[model samples]
Target: MTKNRWDNGITHHDGEAREFISTYFSQTGRRVLILASAGFDLRSTAVSRAIAQTGVTCRGIFIREERPNADQALRARADKNAEQLKIVVPDSKVVFIDIFDPVDQAVVGARRLTRDVLPILAEGEPPTDIVVDASALSIGISFPLVRLLDNLYGQKPGTPNVHLFVTEDPHQDDQVKPDHAERPMWVPGCDGDAGSDLKSKSIRLWIPQLVLYRTEALRRIHDFVDATETCPILPFPARDLRRGDVLLEHYRTLLIDTWEVDPRSYIFAAEREPLDLYRTLLRIDDARQKVYGQQGGSLMVLSPIGSKLLGLGALLAALDRDFPVAYLETVSYAAQLGAMKNLEPDDWPIVHLWLSGVPYA
Candidate 1:
């Protein structure tokens, strides 16, 4: 197997926006195009900044859920966000996607993206580099499109890379409350339904989604892995201030002092959403060889990520690298004690995937 580079770590929200464009542009020598999902929050600053700094155009596929019972204020907030993005990002067009709709329906994001979004983004630019804001999108829309676009671009001789980006501000998320009582649920999306091998000493790295509520049960991950074997490895990007984040800090303390998990486990990856973590885990020599070689080996898997892009990353790692995938789905995530719900299968609107062809290596 060839060596893969894992470029990840935390940069201050404001500082990293401009940095992402300049750095990626220089490396790839390709124009930046952000394939992002819009939300009620004004977090699109990162996307706007990248466009302003690079002067490259962007086309977006915004997934807007049709929550009929949503408060008028919520609807207004979303409207304002949509308006703000257009104003901030030059030469950008946003395609509204209602992911809950059926494939034949007019509002289905997957269909719209395939029909309207891709053609515009592809026009003029033969290889437009994609910057996906996988931080907050329904798995229904995120998965199929990512698989489609990544492969669509990957097939061409000079296939432009589909880069991943995710941003989470505990400060903003904590303003709301969620219940602490959570139940662990398993996530689907594995090839062979095999049992996890807890005896392996080889690295079984875990990419956590959000540490909002499950801070306590995280230790149980060790129960699954042998004591001699590192049960649950926690990886967090640096440049984070845990002052207000009690649960996250608590877990960090446990990882370093109580659990004796190696310092190497705490990943200093892209603060918002960087594809590096997934790429690194996918390229792991031991797991890659064992799983890819189709040897009698099982790779450990855990994902608490809230971002669908991260979820896509997890799924890709599991499917391509041959790792067994599972999730600790909370018992009830009905916006319960400020619980930051982990990503799960049911949360996503759909499970089916649509791609033009197989992904390129």
Candidate 2:
């Protein structure tokens, strides 16, 4: 396994992901903190643990959102997961936090940075490094976790380095049920007339993060903007046969029919490699700023990203500069009793990781 770290702002690495995990566990004086969304992806979790040569201290911080239906399912799975973790790695501390306080959500800024999040990590000895998996999470919990991790990195410089990872294996061959959407709305990134003539300037840039569930929202954008001015960005995960062909066809029709632009040309696409997605956002923002700085009257917009790490990257980019972000918020969610079809074990190996909050002295 090879490793590559980011140069510009916050340091991030991308390499053979499994290799990183193996190397991380093998080191001495390391403590592991696994944030359990539901349960550990048994396969990946075992592989990571097996590589640890030195005896490593490990613990789990399980998440239970304030929702009733979801929490019920999560509780059952988390209990089983905790049992399994204890068996695999003895005496591991397992904690369950009841998050998603409505009042907390209503709060304007970061509510739990010092209060809830820091306290959780501060428990036990400080970790040397942290490995976070954002795969099992839906949009809501993942958003807050991403925000929390970002805040952690922003805070003390000497804090332990974080390795954020997610598994995305959209099994193309499997018959999948469509995700239920309460309403599919595609709101603009910045405040201008919704259908304002996009051709006012020769250069307008739009980067819409693509996913199967957001088909309607993407269509809404295609209808709203000149397709030539848009750069549709899709996440190419390690294993993603993300079968959004219907949505892709719909987008292709609009781009060709309306703006006469090649889908290939109006696309700034790449595979998201761990934290590099964060770097990609920074780079995209830099390019957009360069465009506007050199030539006034050019508009640039960043659309909503589905992946937690990538979403955090976009958030960081906007925080520094007034980067516009288009959003489609979900009103409700459905929780399945069993593993969801396409998102099951065959699509993915159940994954969890040991994250260290403090580097060993």
Candidate 3:
């Protein structure tokens, strides 16, 4: 009988997981704000350590789900954990907010929490760079915060440099329910299946794991608020504050216009595997070269081998070229071709190279 090593009690980490976390910490430098829920664990501790090692200032805002004093056991555990974290990382900043209310209520509470906490932010400092760690929050709660941030502050320029990290929980894997085996199947033309043939098409959706924003961009968003009216649905008090809907509407308009005119403003990916990164770099390079034209084109390549090849190619191609030319990877030609529905045989030759795992030439 063959034995499965992992079937026992050993925890194994994948390279992609390590790479993702490393890349996240290495990428950001500004003040970091971590938003966590009651389920915070060792992963959060690891993240805090990584940030501290990077010499970046870090603050954690933990949302408590249990009532104080009523649940002594749970409260004690929570308090002990919070205390340990403080002792371990004494210099680290931490704040706790009660969120014992229901989901909708908690969401409103969080918004109000953010508003009230804004005053606690140091005065005269440029809006501290913010990073909301939504790995712990439910999608309902997490999505709202994301929408709020995106509405208030747009992405940082150059690279979407903000690091939004989500940690996958083991419990989450068990929560996925299998499809029902007894579910009825639909076939067309049969009396019972006539209308049943109208099956809903499965739509594949991709949500970005990380969202980075420029500090200035977020400040601009907050500045638009009037601070007089109470923002409804948000836990914050009603003062003469600008409506959340109005701010969000303006944000949507700006995002759409910016994306259409400047694809550089957004870096979206179905997944962030290394392969995807390589492909994205190639695509960007190709687009830049195309826009600039052959005469004045400058190639910027991110991959090490690609960069070396580009330098050599520029020299060799420079000698007998009819037009000034540079070869680089900004965008993957494969990805572009794949997006198209059909391809001519002529195009297949190039496409074949990509499909065969050959890097862009």
TM-score per candidate, in order? Answer: 0.56, 0.62, 0.37
Who is ahead in lDDT, 2 or 3? 2
Off by over 4 Å in 1: 1-32, 89-93, 101-127, 138-140, 176-210, 214-237, 240-296, 306-361
Name the runs in model 3 displaced over 4 angstroms.
Answer: 1-30, 38-42, 66-73, 88-94, 100-107, 120-124, 127-129, 156-161, 172-361
User: How much is 311 displaced in model 2, in angstroms?
Assistant: 5.5
Q: Write the per-residue lDDT of candidate 3 for residues 227-260, one digit (tens) a residue.
A: 1111111101112133323333544543444322
Q: Per-residue CA lDDT of candidate 2, range 111-167, in tens?
A: 332245557787777766665555554333454565466556634567765555555
TM-score-best of 1 and 2: 2
lDDT of each: 0.46, 0.47, 0.31
- Backbone collision tally, model 2: 11
- Show how many residue pairs clash in every candidate, following the order shown: 19, 11, 21
Q: How do the residues 1-361 of candidate 1 rate in per-residue lDDT, one tens digit apiece?
A: 5433222322223345445555645553456566665555435344544444555555444545443244465456567766766665655676765433444332244555566666776666554466666544444455546656655664355566566554555444544332222333233334123343432534444444545555555554444432332333223443354432444465666666776767454433343343544565655535545663544333456453443334554555554554544443221123322344343311212111111121333
Candidate 1 accuracy as lDDT? 0.46
